[model samples]
Target: MLPFALVASTLNSGLVSASSYKPRASVCNGHAELCDRSYGNVTFIGSHDSYAISATQVAANQDQNITTQLNDGVRMLQVQAHSYDGSIHLCHTSCLLLDGGLFSDYLTEVNTWVVANPNEVLSILIVNSDNLNASMYGAVFETSGLDKVSYAPTKATTSVADWPTLGSMIDSGLRVVTFMDNSADFTTVPYIIDEFSNVVEDAYNAVEDSFPCTANRSTGTPENQLVLTNHYLDQVGSSTSIVTPNKSKLNQTNAETGTGSVGQGASNCFQIYARSPNFILLDFYDAAGLAPFNVAAELNDVSAPTNTVANYTGGDGSTSTSTKSTASTTSTSSSLSGAGPQFKSEMMPLIVAVAVAVMAGSGLMLA
Candidate 1:
């Protein structure tokens, strides 16, 4: 039988080997500087109009399900909710246009994911089209079991300096943060953060030529609070139909690549605001080879997984697959390679220390 010290050293060595074999976790996992950096300073990939997804084109913002988006590393979900049939539901503009279903159902899925993956942090930005009070949203969260894990900021509005670190929030078990565009009554439900006071987002329906770095809704410089970059492109369609011409072009150029792309829009905003955008909202998140997620990882200086896009099964029982287009008109090839700033330099030393500890422990057991 193995001696006591030998058994413990073997178990420690086995644990280190197993963890090292796992894929690198989220960039925000380690490093106090990155984790404690103001929430406004961190960058997240956001899905614009996230609930408007269907097999058929129905004023869609995203082409896939919420679970798929989360799996692909979307940290922020932006949806419009309205009071429908006594309860709040996720809809686009109006229920007559597109209804994604009950808000509680959506929150349930999110809650399940949150509990399963304790390391991940997520945010929900709701456009309260119905002007429902904060309690209305709070009830849904409570019912869905999401409230238990929600983060309640001490202040009604969080300044750039007041934001907590991602690590701290995770450690405290308050990982899901929420914001509302309107009717966010902090007194009633503290977790329902006021969007306008904390985040400045560009116009949602801006044309490619008109997309600017100027703040439209929120006031003050980007340094004062968090900022969102709206990178979706829309064209004029009939009242009945919102024609998104050049969708392929929009998806191709909207990543964090070169200028003229919507991803470049972030760099443009950075130049004007003097701080990088915290959330980059994109339509057709899986388009152009999942460019939004790739761009987000790059902006945050993390290693992105292989550039793989989801094969979207349409709402109409049809199937459409997305592949990185080799034919890109934008400044650079739309197929972005893993060429971004790396995580904090201290990560290497940390990994080495773990390996050394395992080896030294094993040697001590032999002695």
Candidate 2:
């Protein structure tokens, strides 16, 4: 394998950051049914964001976790539009895809939980990961042994649980923001970075203008290859390019030469379709002004953030975090404890080293 550094190349050295889920209240049994009438404000998170818990955290919190936790929360949900006459679209796993490989996952979770000892979480999974090909819009997304999960789109508008839960959240005071379909390519997936970035930019601007709240997204533009992601990671320079399709890319833009890899002007477009579905499940909604190049540096900056922090592991994996739970919540009750203080602790020594590097290499805006 290529060196880790070379394999996962940093698209850029900058970052844009925002978003910290704030749970207004504790969830309860069968609460989704009472979503609209009594739940109050709702937040829906995709299953992918919910589960991806570190094996360690999952082992710790599995004992007393919610029966289900929404991953899309008031943020946004992604919708992918694929047209494969009879063939299947193979892509990375998505948080909201609820298909195949489900029952086993459910069974594993139950089995793991049963064996947990006090202080030992079977997994740090977000309860919402329970969604599979069964409910939660899951569908059969398979071609060969390489199978994937897909939340059913036909009945997406008729969710029996999410809507009410959203209502409940709204009643309780949560502002349901925007819906983000994991995928939104007007025509075809773009092969060029510019084409992909344009689609994402369009989607981002739409969601930002509509909801105005920070969001996690994986909405791609007719992208057969995963381009725009809604979530963030925490690898060394992870957030810099994991998602946030490069509307403000550091590379040269590709001309819509000949038959573009995507749509006529996808290479330059940066938004979603006007007729897409709303994943918000509720109503209401959220942007990056400078596309902060120093996002990560901003968050951990000794000074307050001037731009979005490094969107990396702010929540999406790539960093030490809890599964079934958001790592970078905006505001939660006092009961919620901060995660991985060690990550924060490690920052100082690194900063000291970087300080010396700066003196030797040059000076720059860490933020």
Candidate 3:
């Protein structure tokens, strides 16, 4: 199938899987940058960035040369994006969220693209920050009633899950995202975990609240899944199934898996979501349970199990239950204003002033 692409939009999907790349400089003869490719040991060079496109670049298809390389046996679409606009997302200012289009519209487009371009575009790569400067992005998925990808703040006093980006992604089917415990004793890289849960819930309630009623994690698989593909994303046996996650319960082996390299998970995020066997709950439990693997970069020299989208794992571990509800599939977005007003800023912005002084006098890298 001709992979589902995020085309026809006004803004270019930015550059696929890159912020550090300049087309002319990165291309070697007629190929993509060596760094931009490589999913585990699989050698990925399909559609690079599917979500973060810029208009002019979009029109030109700067990545098509590599796409041609994928002509015969393309199985994954690798995407890459930085979380913040550098100076923007950090300071407390309102700005456009990353998923630039309307959440409903965007979701609809994804479904359409998946249908239109089957098997080729399987996964999504999210190398951006969790908090965008926009609120609409946050509101639609995590907030109450909005249709855009607006940004919300990772407020000084906000709950981690309530951050605008997390809420929206979760609402949009992000199943799991567990960084290192932040306090684990393992010497792993600080990583980022983003599991795409296709359950697609209302930003207003828990995924359990919307349609089916699945239990929380620690217990076995939620009862809501056995009969359905609720949280456990992949089928019993498919090429996409993961081979060596925690260890092999099947062969009774415990040789630990390392952050071998950036594997096929990120290289196939968007394309795989199209089919049912194409999904996997995103998670980042410390193989050693030491720290959160820092997922902010594309190829961080962090540690083993480096960064993956939602690749399969070997062995049929456990399963969720089947205690569900008769729910409606209608779209319903809510607003964050209902949670009371956004926090009013307190101090007169001393941090900005201080940062400026330090940068100006110290020749700091903050610029």
Q: How high is the CA lDDT of each candidate model?
A: 0.63, 0.22, 0.22
lDDT of 2 by residue, 285-340 (tens): 00121121112112112122232221122222223212233323322111112253
Show where candidate 2 strays beyond 4 Å.
1-40, 44-103, 107-162, 165-367
Cα displacement (Å) at residue 260, model 1? 3.7
Lowest lDDT 10-residue stretch of candidate 2 = 281-290
Q: Cα miss at 155, model 2 (Å)?
A: 6.3
Best by lDDT: 1
**Candidate 1 C-alpha lDDT tens digits along 198-237:** 8888776665644576887884454577788777766653
> Which stretches of model 3 miss by more than 4 angstroms?
1-41, 46-49, 52-100, 117-121, 132-367
**Ranking of all predicted structures according to TM-score, beginning with the best and ending with the worst:** 1, 2, 3
The candidates, ranked best first by lDDT, are 1, 3, 2
State the lDDT at 69 in candidate 2. Answer: 22
lDDT of 1: 0.63
C-alpha TM-scores of all predictions: 0.74, 0.23, 0.21
Count of backbone clashes, every candidate in sequence:
4, 90, 67
User: Model 3, range 1-367, lDDT digits (tens) per residue?
Assistant: 1121221120122222223322222321112322232111112222222332211111111111112212312223322222344321211111221222233333343343333332222232232334332322233223322222221222212221122221223233321222210121112211122222211211111112121212222112221111111111111113222111222121111111212211222222223222111121221111111111222122222122222221112113521111221211222121110122122211122234344435665321110
